[model samples]
Every structure is written in structure tokens, then in C-alpha cells.
Target: MKPFSKLREECGVFGAALRSGEAAGLTYNALLALQHRGQEGAGIAVAREGAVFCRKEVGLVSEVFDGRALESLGRAGLAIGHVRYSTTGQNICENTQPMVIEYLRGRIATAHNGNIVNALELKRKLTEHGCVFVGTGDTEVIATLIAYEALRAAAPSPDPGTAPADPAPSALSAPAAPDSAVEAAVVRAAKQLVGAFSLVVLTPDKVIALRDGTGFRPLCLGRSAEGYAVASESCALDSAGFTFVRDIRPGEMVVITPEGVTSRQVLPAARQGFCVFEYVYFARTDSVLDGQSVYQARYEMGRMLAAEHPANAEVVCGVPDSGLEAAAGYAAESGLPLVSGFVKNRYIGRSFIFPSQAQREAAVRLKLNPLSFNVAGKRVVLVDDSIVRGTTSRKIIASIRAAGAKEVHMRISSPPFRHACHFGTDIDDEKALIANNMTIEEVARHIGADSLGYISPAGLKTACVHGSLPLCMGCFTGEYPLFVGRHTKTQLETR
Candidate 1:
């Protein structure tokens, strides 16, 4: 058992092409801003002098990348970085990203967000074609597929002397015009892939940003004095001192070079399936994804939750990090006083890699402690983002009760998580989820809460400011945006 009760956000990817600032250093800062997306592993790959220099390890960004590691990456024109939580792979260094590779054409390093639906089938086919893998991670698999396709698209027919094939005359067909071919190859590879993905790929001269056709994951483009930056959230862009540009639309790819930026729509315009949970939990409250402010959306979620599930409590307090915004909304809507019920340790990283469930449960108290002075003898309304296994919640409630809280009403900002998330969340299989088998009342009892209330499905939808963009609610609804199913979360890691 993973010992985590909340769904883990998969990965955060950041890419930059800079004219002045060092790509690696600026990206390190960007990763720090985007670290909440994942804490299992961290990595950065820089394209320097046409070869890639990379340093990656399984740990939080700060813990994994030391001053020497940053120095090893040095400065480069183009760089890509990733902070990962293992949705598709296991928590291991081999699964850490910024998956770099070499091919007949040149070097390309890629950092990816989102999971591939057909990764297992793709791996089988690639293996039969003589591709050997170092680790069972979809990011590495994707990098290999892109490299192979790029080489294939650029390769010409063999000659009698066994020399490389000659190129045609047009700009698009010319061999020396390498970036165009690579971009086209990337677009082709993107078309072949199914399911959600947001990729930031780095070559020697350019940084490429891509989003899946349906845009199940967030990827946005921004501009800086140095050049361009692409990240999982606009907050990372702001951290890098970049001006917010529009999102890299679904099915779109942008190639950024010293000459400027060029765009291509690989897939036709379609309904956007932007992840709604980004606003609900994963994204920075400051980020605007798909034209909607995440903070405003979360505030709306709190208001909606209050409208549907009103509680008679003296004070409302949200979970330390993401739930805070919603907590404010709840307080404003219900006219109840809001106060801090628990104080979290800012230095403690997410315990995704704890060796055992017992250790993880024990470590929970170290990360968050109840404010006995505030919570004592009060009817406390505890708000949190979506919960799964109920292990962590039980711990939190037990501590609060031990501190002399009179009543604890558990309120979730999102609906019950009954289904597995196949896109990028690590929640997989009904057996692992307490909600899959237990009713809301049963769950409240299991977690030691006095009462429990969840935001309804419609309430969750209307809470987002994503006006017309369709959102992926598959995890709560048991309906997927894409056409793939039955695969296990750890299967990719097992390979």
C-alpha cells in the first residue's frame, strides 16, 4: 500500500531557451516553483555544444540537485527539467526524467508530463524492433519513439555505395534544415501517440513545447527577457520573471529558436479536455490555466461546496497547502470565521518515497501538527482536497481529537474519488480506494471524523472558471477522456 490518502500529481516539466540568463540555473528556480506537482524525483538536461549534459536523481528538487549538480549542467542556450511523481513508473532513480538520448541526427532531451495510454503495447512493439530500454518509464519510451521517428523522417533511401540518402530541394525537404525535420518528426510522433502528454523537448539550438490533442494536461508558453519558457503552470513562468503568453493549445507544438518562435497545429481544433483538477488541487493558486485563474476557480469550488454542504461549525480551516484557498471561499460564503487549525512544517517534503506504509503514516505527524490552542473545544470544519485511502486523514483526525477538538466535520473540495485516474494521477485500481467499497458515512467513520460531506459532481464542475473548456473528471466519474483501460499504474514501472 502507498500509505497516501490523496491523489499524487504526476510531474512538472519546465523548458527554457535563453539569450542571456543561464538556462540550467533559471530552470532550477522554475522547478522550485513547480515542485508541488511532484516530489519523487528531479532532473535537468541542458543542450550544450550539440550534446546534452544531464543530472537527475530520485528525490525532491532541492535534495536531488546540489550546487555541484547545477554547476555540472553549466549554462546552455536550451534546457529542459522535470520534477516527477510516479504515476506510470515506480519511485526509482531510473524512472527520473529529462530522458536524454542520441541518434543518427543529433541529441534531444525531453521532460514529459502525463501518462501514455498504450505504453505497454508500444514497449512490446519497440522491443521487437530491437529497442532496448534502461528503465520502464513512459518518458524514456516517448523519447526513444521521438528519436526513432525523427531519424526515420529525415533518413533518405540507401544508395548502391551504402551512403546516406540525398535530400530534395525544397525548404521542408532539405536535409541541412535539420530543425524543421525534427519538428515535423515530432509532430508526426505526437499524432501517433494516444492519451495525455505535455512535452518540453530540447535540442542543441531550440526548445520545443507540445501538448496532446485533447490537452488533458496543462502546458503553457511564456516570454522572458532572456527568451522563452514553457512549464506545467504559469507560476513557474512568473518565478522565472517571464511574461505570460497564451497556453500552448491542444494539438499545438511550438518550436523556439534564436530566430524566434514558430508554431504548427499537428491535430485539428477539438474540444479541450484540460484537467479540471489543476484548479481544484494540482496547480499553483496563482497560475492561470486554459484562460482560467486557478485561485479563482478554487475559491469558486469552496463557494460551491458551501452552497451544497453547509455545516454548523465555529471555524473553517483548509488543509495546509491547496485546501487553503477553498477554505477562504467557504468562510466567505458561509460567513463563518476562518482560522488556522494546523501548522505544517514548511521544510518537510512530500513523503512519496518512504520505504513502507507504516513509516509514511508515522511521518505524517512530523509534517503537520494540530494547533491545540485554536482547535481545542471548537466545532472545527476541516477542508481538504480529494482523499483516497483514508490513512492520512485518520492520522490527522486522531491528532486533532487528541488535542481536544470538540467536533471535526470533514469536508472535501472535490467529489469522492471512486475511479482510478489513468491520465497522470497515480491512483489506480478500485481495490486501493476506500471509496470504491465504502459509502460516505462508512468512510467518515473509518477516518474517525464526526461527519463527512463531499462536493457533488455538478458542484465540482461549476466551481471551475473554465467556461467552455471540457474538463477531465474521469477519476471521479469512472469515465475516461481517452479510449484505453485496465492497465495498472505500476505496470510501466514493472517492465
Candidate 2:
């Protein structure tokens, strides 16, 4: 809860399948562990006897689901959950996940993390073909696609003489097993999807998960005592009593049923494009993603920052919660004493509550206080993960000066966010990013720091242990790995 700066999580997803009892409780717990990913809304949905039961609202997970509410979901064979910070949609109950629907293949409760670049086009096509739309969010679009595809996959061929008299094909009926039919439908829908996504689907007999071919977001499988669970981060799985299984490969679909786990590769694995922000800010410090330790990556980023941009200071301090590990690494590399600069108020939280620009600007002090004893009269080097608009960083620097620090040099661990993010990390407007407009020198003056330095893209990659994987550095380099829309390409046209 410390380090009350602003970095947002686009969304988080969790699901469990083929368990003995109600899985909503486990889903709820997973959401708690992932609460950092979002705070605007929360929901959980369960599938029981070919029907879906969902309860959701705009609030924190604890505020949305209580013991009584979890009890209401009752015992179910499968369940899926979601916590979201909107990037492509507005905040509304209708937009909250998991989006449940009844199609030809019984019913399903679906949850998703990441934005859909082609959501508008797909929704338009679905509507032209007679699919009635309810919510404006992309999750609903994905649900509808799966429903229609499942219906098509389950539809029996026109055996003119032997065609069934039924008006609609029963999704659970012959040709293939019901579970298999649902999974095929999911694969079909996933193929049509374009952009970042880690989807969790709940059917009557199985729980299914699908990750985008690029793997721009994190998704992993875990083995629980009762069954299998999937989450955007393994820490959540660990919190839910699931042992870490390997991360689900890119473009892979993993199905968990009573028979255990099964998987199929839908897309040819091409280049891997994981979000570097996960290691820097989105994921918990204790979690690991894509074979790299987030804590180690951050620690190394600090060490690398110290090596590349050593600051002349008596002591080094980190912006709590986010920059602590890196500060330690910086201290180790520079051989400077590490100290706590700010004490964060755990009671205050989740920046969205301060809606207005003025309110948000003032919130910095309400959440963090510079410790005079730790920083007084010392030339201190302040290390932070990233500075979005430089608003809070400016305020924090002013506070440190007021608290008696002789000189405050700001050291950032990641490259500047110069472009908008389209695949769901929540910085969609380029103008809102300070780095897009300010030079390194200009930014330092604006933030009231003696000097400022950000980790170079190459340095950041090295710190994260990035090897041959093709990373999504669009926000930094303006070079998108894959193209989705003309507008998206045009925005990153400078590179």
C-alpha cells in the first residue's frame, strides 16, 4: 500500500474449473491478490448445470463480494473472475466482467484481461448478422463471438433428408463432446480476435483459458488442491492455494476438466511480446513472469541505473513500494547507504478516487510524507519506477526539498512513455504523458529535481533479462511489433 504514485493495471482475470464445490471463494481470493491490477470494478461468475450465475458491481473486490455474496453463487463446476481498470471502455456495471452468455453450447461465464484492437469491427459485423448488443465494452464482444462460433461449430451439417427439425442446434449435442465443442468454439473466436488478451471461460464441463499469440499480457496455470486455476499472475494462484505450474505459452489454449489439464496450440508461435511494465510496476514484487523474476528484474534495473547514471549523493532512497528493490540494487552498485525517504499512508489508495486534476495533484501529500530524519540535510538520490505525467514526481521533489534534503536527483528505471498504449496498459492519450512533450532537461526542471536520468531502453532490457523475445516497446520506441489498425500504426508513425 506504500508508494502512492500513479501506475495503473489494465485488468486482471482468474478462473477455476471441475472443482468439487463452489469456486467463487477461490476466484474472490485471487481477485484480492490481483486487486492492484484494478479497483474501479469487480465481479465473479459461476457455471452450474449449463447455466451461468454472475454477480458484479463497480467497486473493489472486498466491497463487491462478501461471504454472503459468495454463498449466493453456490456450488458450481466452474468459475471465472475479473478486476478491471478500463482502457477502451467506460466505467459501468454493465461493462463489469465476467460477461455471461447462453449460446448454442449451453452457457458460459467469461473474463478477460487486455484490450481488443478489432473489437469495433467484430461488434459491427455481429450486429449486422442479428446479434443484439448490450454492453459497450470489448468483453461483451468477445462473449458474443464465442457464442456465435459455438453455435456454428455445434450446428449439424445440412443432410437434406436427415436434417433435424429443431430451430437451433443444441450446443451440447453430438458430433463431438460438449466440452470439445465449447473449446473449438473458443479457438475459433480467439483466431478472429486481434490484440492483447488472456481469456478465461467457464462452461458446464470445463474451464478454458486462451492467451494472445503475442503474449503481451501475463497468464499462467496452477495446480490447486482440488483442481486447476488460471490467473494473470502466479502470485494470485499462490494466494489461492495453487502450486505454480508453468506459464501458459503464447497462442495456447489450456482446458481444465475433471480429467486434468489439456492444451492445443492455435496460432503458430512467432515473436513473443510481453509487456515490460509488468516487471516494472504491474505485477507484485514476489511474482515471476515468463521465466524472469519480477523482483530480480527490478533490483537489476536499479543496479543498472546506478551503473549507467551514478548520482553524487550522501544517501540513496527509493519511492516506497515501487522503487524499494531498485534502491537496494542502486545502493549496492554505488556503494551508497540506502534509506527510506517517504512513509506511505496505507489507509489511502487507488488514485481514481481523486477524479479532478486539482484533486489528484493534492493527493500526493495526503498519501506520502517525506521523512525528515531519513533525508534531512543529505544530498539524496531518489529512485522511482516511472514518472507518467511528472505531476506527482514534481510534488514529491518539492516535498523532499521542504523536508531538508540538500539535493534530490531523480532516477527512473524505465524509458520514457512517449506514445499511447493500445494493448491495454491504460496510457491511451499521448498528451497525458510528460515524456511525450518534455526533454530530459526540461523534465528535471519541471519536477524540481537537481538532475534526472531514466534507464535507457537497452539498459532496461538488460535489467529485465530480455533475450531473443520480441518485446512490445511501442510506448518507448514507438515501434509496434504487430499492426492492428491504420490509426494505431499512424500514431506510432514517427518511429
TM-score leader: 1
Off by over 4 Å in 1: 1-3, 155-177, 269-271, 350-362
Residue 303 C-alpha lDDT in model 1: 86
Residue by residue across 12-95, what tens digits does model 1's lDDT show? 999988886388998999999999899889999988786777899998889988898898887787888999988777778888
Index of the highest-lDDT prediction? 2
lDDT of 1 at 319: 84
lDDT (CA) per prediction? 0.81, 0.81
Error of 1 at 245 (Å): 0.9
RMSD of each: 4.7, 5.2
Give all TM-scores, in the order shown: 0.92, 0.91
Clashing pairs in 2: 104-171
lDDT of 2 by residue, 395-425 (tens): 9999899999999999999988887677876
Q: What is the lDDT of residue 423 in candidate 1?
A: 81
lDDT of 1 at 295: 86
